[model samples]
Target: MSQRQVVQVFEQYQKSRTQFVQTVAELATRPMNIEILQNAGVMSLLRPLLLDIVPTIQQTAALALGRLANYNDDLAEAVVKGDILPQLVYSLAEQNRFYKKAAAFVLRAVAKHSPELAQSVVDCGALDALVICLEEFDPGVKEAAAWALGYIARHNAELAQAVVDAGAVPLLVLCIQEPELSLKRIAASALSDICKHSPELAQTVVDAGAIAHLAQMILNPDAKLKRQVFSALSQIAKHSVDLAEMVVEAEIFPAVLTCLKDTDEYVQKNVATLIREIAKHTPELSQLIVNAGGVAAVVDYIGNTKGNVRLPGIMMLGYVAAHSENLAMAVVISKGVVQLAITLSEEPEDHIQAAAAWALGQIGRHTPEHAKAVAVANVLPRLLEAYLRAGATEDLQTKSKKALKNILQKCVHLPALEPLLHDAPPNILKHVVGQFSKVLPHDSKARKLFVTSGGLKKIQEIKAEPGSALIEYINTINNCYPEEIVRYYSPGYSDSLLDRVEQYIPA
Candidate 1:
């Protein structure tokens, strides 16, 4: 063959290989084509191309593999079983920046599916290669490697510790401080994924001076970067009291409170969640949030938002109030209960309603004053209504019932207790009756209203079993009213003599 003819044939071969990989990359973008591509024995065809003499063909093949593995776990396992991972990991260290990015992406795609799949990537020494990629001069390589490391570490603690063992933490910490916005975002997210698995892991990130760097990024103008920074802080704060205190010591509170009103809803939610995590550990932490007006910011966020965005705000109130009666009062002073009552009554999702119920319970469970605060918002009836509805979730019913019992045991407000007598079921009715038993014996006007409003008649119809607390409360309330009136309202009395004017006799 002539030399010119041989060169023409080689060029044709490279062109076809390039077209095949590029076509697969385009087809991979549509999820519906994954099975079609796999059925065409794409993995068998693509495996040999990972080591193509031309770098574009190699990188594009890796890109196609990453997309296939990213679509689902079965395809990810296909990449693993086809022996594609080992070849990619081997090429990852020797490749150019684009190939390194593509190979690291494939590793991340496989590892993100499950711990076993991730362990397979680890077994192929992908972490060592990816860690080396993080040290590359190219920013894109660093970002891709950080993202892959985060995915590998995200599955569980063992895998996370494995990434730590590969010496990725200090590199990732340096990546967060880099001038590139995308790198900072990805690196912060990677740090959060690393630290979220355990207290010890979080301490590792903290010891690397991550909190100070992350806290400084909170002031960055980029919305996405701010989201990751707040997320890292929240994860670190959630692990333990000492860790939570470390986050607070960074002086991120009032700055985070300002973010509660930020235009970004996620920023608002993460800020509330971070505050809640800090407040959840101890009374002193709760007081720190209260002192910073964190409760009020959360209250405003809850008021303006809907669905899941407001959930963190609602829970922050619960955590703050759960710490002590004084913090509970702080929530009440901020109009937190009213917002929670609104959410419980007006929100569409059952889980959100359940969260609001749980929050209101926290606010009202502390003391009589707190109970009255919740009662004044008219949350009691809404809670009872939600609890009794047939479609309410078991979680909602359980939380609502517990809230009722908690507040009712502390409530001194007679007017709020009256409406519940008309509709409460036996488990909840006992609480209503018990609250009345406490108040009616002391207040004559309330006792008179209890009868005139047919509340006493409502109690009479309950016919609680012998020696039950409902019956005991009934007896206590019965003694507070006139015996004749009580006997008239008692079961079977009206049936006995209402029609017999000439001869009236009790049953």
Candidate 2:
């Protein structure tokens, strides 16, 4: 079929009543039709079919595009650029709750594509329509509108700020108090978005005494609500460190820690993630986690487990270490942590290795001695090998490089040092020297050794000390011998020299 003819056929197909059934099926099985709906000359053809139709077309359009929206921005923009928005808004006021719910979904898809388009959706009186839906409408519409507003408010900060400015917080706060999990999830997510850009709005929620109720959801009997609440809390903690501190102070740690033991891996992962984020600005909270025995759980997961669980445990360690030096050190002391951290870089999964590499970096930043153990354990070479296996990602390479530098800086004179210096890759030696310079300038031992060894000899001879006659001849022969070398190695100082000389022998 000709391309234009094919377009006409699809256009004609969209116009028939039988096509509506087929469209729903197509939307369920495939979402590409929404893009076809927006092609040049296609919207003009489809608009006539949808102009007076009972929003079934619009519902199908929303479903089609929402599924496809994440993968294809062009198709999403085309829907917003078309006139389906007003129809969706009009449907929000319909007596039939199904239409209103469908409209909410479409509005959500529009908001996802462009916040600017949401203004038109709101300008079409969708906000008020949505508010009424929250209060007066079907459960489905209420949930859909709540989810839509959450997306808009979160993705479009200005719209969220406006929504809060318009006194939407009170209604949203009420929705958070709902007994229904679905409504509460949507409400909490929406409120989080509003508070994200408006701390004052968050204060409004807090001052209105929402924390206790929200905290209860973290320990809620419903696992789904618990996840939603935890997700909301994670976002809130991002905005208000004080509130996060307050949550921890109010004994939320015990409940959050309990989630660390959930049978469901997803619940366990999210709980660990939330705890990690909250610990970022509150280092003291790390003690709470440690006291609650989170270290054992995280270490055991990393050492013995695999897959998603192991990966999150690495990220959690990084987060925990970031906030507390004690916790970072504690991770190093944990059984098999060093070995497992090295193993992570060799795991078949690249993401797991990346997380491990990141955690190792965090450990190095907090404790150089522990960082040395990790490096000398051959973790540095393992990480470099993983970096090669993993394709180019600027962040991964940057983080991996920082971790490697820390390892080198701490262990330059270690037993593993010579191998890294001689047998290791040439680039590895260059990196080691680069990192060594960063710390070596401040090291008296390094400075003394550099001057005593003539500074120009191969690093292989760096620890070798000449006999007294040789030293005297060198001091007498070289006009510019370093002052410390002359002062320490002259005449009667021979015994002191012999004492100093024995300290650096390779054996």
Candidate 3:
């Protein structure tokens, strides 16, 4: 039928009979017929049908509006502009389950267009109505209401806060605990959206008992659900230190560490990311990760996986190393320093290289022994090279320079001394020489080897002028081991002594 024919049929049926409105309602449900109905300016006509005494016309008209709004944003905005939201909100409380479900479907489509339209729906008090629907007997109505709320809450912080303020969090948590896996997934996802907006909002979800539910769900062997659960936990953990501690208090490390070895790459990456977030700046949490074998798991992934899967693991190792001296030493004990250095030196991707450099820098910030471990891995030359390479981003350069400075200032092992003397920038070399004077004891083998390895000659060349720190350090080393230095450079220097010194040097 043409637009005029549809309009004429509606006009003839106006206030005349229920059968006429029902006929038009049935026609509105068809996709091909919506254009004709719209051309007839039927949105105004459909408004009264939303309140029709007959349940069939009410259900069909709401379903038709939903279908029509699904076609494009203009129709959805038209539905909102016609004041359909309050009517839909009212229909959600109807005794008839069909009317409630159909109204929720329409509202979901209408509010899915944009943040402005979503706020329009929320402003009409649709959030309270949707929260009420969660307690309904019909699962379909509950699921649809949860979906609509999820769509709105996912758009922006204000709408999400609106949803939470309407007391939707506990109800959504209830939905997640239900036996139906599909509804549980939707509810979990909605809670994730709600918590992702901010720490205050995320704490609200945690206070409502989401962490326990999500932690339990993460343990399931199903890879798909585990992915969703890990992602939700990660979002929650990202916004606050308290939430991260809650994740640890829930004892989620074992399950999370298991996910690091998951066959699915996305699952592995997200789980690694969650671990990284939890380990940030919390020494106790970092130790928990280390105790649970998380450090080894990440190191193995960086060694065994390629492309995107390895990047998050590298980053996790970095976060774990940054927390404390003991944790940094743990990373060195696990050979993480060697793995990170390899990535910095050999990985083609600049992001991975930058991340590796960052992890090394963290490791280098601890005691002199920790710095010596990194230096023995032969990472300083690669860091210097990465710092000098053309086209490196400011972030890459900053990380490289920071790592180089940390190693030079802390490491006093003799084998790590030559590279600083020969390869480090002038400013860094000055710091290295000063650090050596402080860290090396007067009678130490490392001090003896420093003079034997041409360290004094290199320092004299790099010193700016007489009585500088470099020059002063040279005087201290010479005063401490004058005889050994002269014997080492003399014609009859023992090969065994030189061989012992060479053993400490990296190949």
Q: Model 2: per-residue lDDT, tens digit, 268-350?
A: 76676667666666667666777777766777656656677666567777777766667777777774357456556557766
Order the numbered candidates by lDDT, best leading. Answer: 1, 3, 2
lDDT, candidate 1, at 263: 90
- For model 3, which pairs clash? none
TM-score of 3: 0.74
The better-scoring model by lDDT among 1 and 3 is 1
lDDT of 3 at 268: 85
How do the residues 1-507 of candidate 3 rate in per-residue lDDT, one tens digit apiece? 999999989866654545655666677567788778788887887788888777877887787788778666888899989988888897787648898888888888888889988888888989999999999877888888898999899888899999999999999999888877777777887888888889988999999999999888876776766776788798898887778988888888776777777888878888888888888747887888899998988888788777667787787778888888889888998999988988887788877788889999999878888888998898888888888888988888888888888877787666766776787776677777777667555547776566667775565455466778767865665566566664555443578677788887776
Clash total of candidate 1: 0
Q: What does candidate 1's lDDT look like per residue over 1-507, in tens digits?
A: 999999999999999999999999999999889999989999889999998999999999999999999999999999999988989888888879999999999999999999999999999999889999889999999999999999999989999999999999999999998999999999999999998989999999999999999999787889899899999999999999999999999998788888888898888788888888898999999998889888888899999899999988888889889889999999999999888999998998999999899989988998989999999899999999989999889999999999998899899898888889888888888888998999899998998888888998888898789998888999999898778998898888877775675576657
TM-score of each: 0.95, 0.69, 0.74
Q: Tell me the whole-model lDDT of each prediction, alpha carbons only.
A: 0.91, 0.62, 0.81
Which sequence of candidate numbers ranks them by TM-score, best first?
1, 3, 2
Output the better candidate (2/3) by TM-score. Answer: 3
Candidate 3 backbone overlaps, count: 0
Maximum-lDDT candidate: 1
